[model samples]
Target: MTFKSINPANGEVIASFEEDADYALKIRLGEKSFDRWKNTGIEERIKLILNLAVILEARKAELAKEISLEMGKTLKSATAEIEKCAITAKYYCQIAEEQLGSIEVSNYAHKAYYKYEPQGGILAVMPWNFPYWQALRFAIPTILAGNVVLLKHAPNVFMSATTLEKLFIEAGFENGIFQNLLVGIDKIESIVADRFIKGVTLTGSNLAGSSLASLAGKYLKKSVLELGGSDPFVVLADANIESAATFAVKSRFQNAGQTCIAAKRWIVVDEVYEEFLNKVSEKINKLKAGDPFNTESDFGPVARLDLAEKIEGQINFLVKKGAKKLINGVRKGCLLTPTLLNMSRDLSHSFTEELFGPVACIITAKNTDEAIEIANETNFGLGASLWSQNLEEGEHLLQKLNAGSVYLNSMVKSDASMPFGGINQSGYGRELGVYGFYEFCNVKSYIIEK
Candidate 1:
């Protein structure tokens, strides 16, 4: 079957491509290629990885445009995403030797050390949001460490998937070092079961992660999942109200409010709750939602009309359950304006669900204890941001949060220097930093008697 990537900003067909008709043959080629690639030295891999940053910079404008057209994100944000991916590629190159090289485990008991060996092939299931950025987190580190990859990107961003494949090819990757497959999700189960695919990494919703992870588990293959999140932005009484409110707007509304790490729930202490609400409402009112290609637009489409519909349904459900809208806004096509809601603390849908759009739901807490209680009440434990003037107290309270990462006074974001992942239903395994690159490696131990 053929697929066409439709521009959400204007509903225009950007490009059409046929799906991989012979995935079996593709997997065979990938497996065979991995056999050869696995033996390559780390020095050669680093050289090729370093070249990616140069290539990405040369074509940054064109690539950023492609991203905006396909996924309907603001041009500025799209460019930032691509630039971050480029930076991450360079970072992996810099630490590859030290991170993946052999390490002495025991020097006296014979000669003993630990070596990182590559698994044959991996299947990457990625989402449309931050398409290039999400995929590169796994692709650069995995491919640079000497493993072949088959990317199963979201159908809506197939243009991005193919574009990235071209980038790797231009950057001197081997034929099967990195390839994009346009097949449907149903194909993933069978692909994972294939002897060639040694592991799987996915960045998507909780439902998608669960189904795919279970299938991979059945096959006894390693799996790393970066799933959904209901991240909290907590505002305490002692916080700098103006600064906290500004960052709250940024953390919640950036990327049109379609981020897993975006602050979806605002749990504020009662002491300054009203003042914080007024600040956020004013900022939300000033946001301009328009065409993604427009440089000055504050918000853009949410990737797909169906996804927009899903978000509206979520909002309506919460509204019926006593969640009242403060600054009501409507949705047009895939573009949703900034919406603010005063969420009920009665265990309603707003607190119990993941709002994956521009709908900001606020809940007032009696004190700091209640704020944290509300923050940790979700099934997702991805990330959380705490706001407080007492930085040391914020640090101590941060431990009470049950997420993979916690920021004392900033938005939770993925960085090449820090390990990023979540526990509980948000999924397992980590990405980024030295810990991220080693997720797919076979840490083999070797010892020789003297």
Candidate 2:
């Protein structure tokens, strides 16, 4: 099958490529690469990854443009994403030795220690929204753990995916360390089911994550999925309204609201609901939606025209369901204005659905209990933000948010040092920090009798 990558900014065909890998070839390459990479010393792997980090920094601008042209992320944001990729690589390079160091445990029968051994070739199915960062987040730790990578990147970011492979090779990595399989979604099941592929990691929609998880389970292989999130941004009556509203707008509108953990629902206390709404709406209107290549543009076009249409469709549905439109939903090419919808009813589609654009659904709550209830009503449990002046109340709400990560007076974001993942429909297993490095590792136990 042939896949054509279209520019999201104006719907022009940027490039086209044919799917080239068969099941047999994928299996063979994975097995062959695993044999070499799994046995390579950790120091050597770390050295190569550090070199890749250097390469990423030197060619940051080039990679940023590729991301912008292919996926419509602003050039500035794309550059930041590349820099984040370099940071991820550098993080593993600096800490792999200590992080993966063998830990000795005392036992009654014998002295045993756990050795962090590679789980062979890992299959990463990444998303286009964060073309580089998503891939690097998984690649850095997996490679540093002495495992080979087989990336089946999002079809839209094909050029960036191939460029990443070249960057790894240029950094003096041996063949098979990081391989980009230019395969379509149809080919993923066979490649993932292969006996040589040890585990799978994905950062995409809930539907895709569920399908991949089911496939991985059919083969009894390990899988880590970071799926969709309808994260709540809850502001209490005692919170700093100005600061909370500012962070709320940034959280919901960043990446044109394409982020998985973007604050989709804003639950504000009735005491300050009107004030918060006015502040947030003002900020939203200030965002400049234009060409992603422009340095001054705050918002860019959605990754694809279809996504924009989907978001618009959701807005229409909300309008039909008695949602009062606080801001008019309009589109120019793939660019969409940041919109706010006040859902008239509590269990409406506008309040329940994951709006993957700059559409924020405001739900007014009487108090803290109501806010928590509204926040946990969604199936997703990825991330949540709680804003309050009271430290005790903020901490208490964090404990009750039902999310993997909770922030107080801050936006929801993943840090390299923190373990990031979710529960329920948001998917399972953890990524980032030491936990992520160990995900693709084996913990074998040994016993001896004296």
TM-score of every candidate relative to the true structure? 0.98, 0.97
Query: What's the C-alpha lDDT at position 351 in model 1?
Result: 51
**Poorly placed runs, candidate 2 (over 4 Å):** 348-351
**lDDT (CA) per prediction:** 0.88, 0.87
Error of 1 at 227 (Å): 0.7
- Alpha carbon lDDT of residue 247, candidate 1? 88
TM-score: model 2 vs. ground truth: 0.97
Which RMSD values do the candidates have, in order?
1.2, 1.5
For residues 16-83, what per-residue lDDT tens digits would candidate 2 score against the true structure?
Answer: 98887564675577678778777778788888888988999999999999999999989999999999
Residue-level error in angstroms, candidate 1, position 337: 0.5
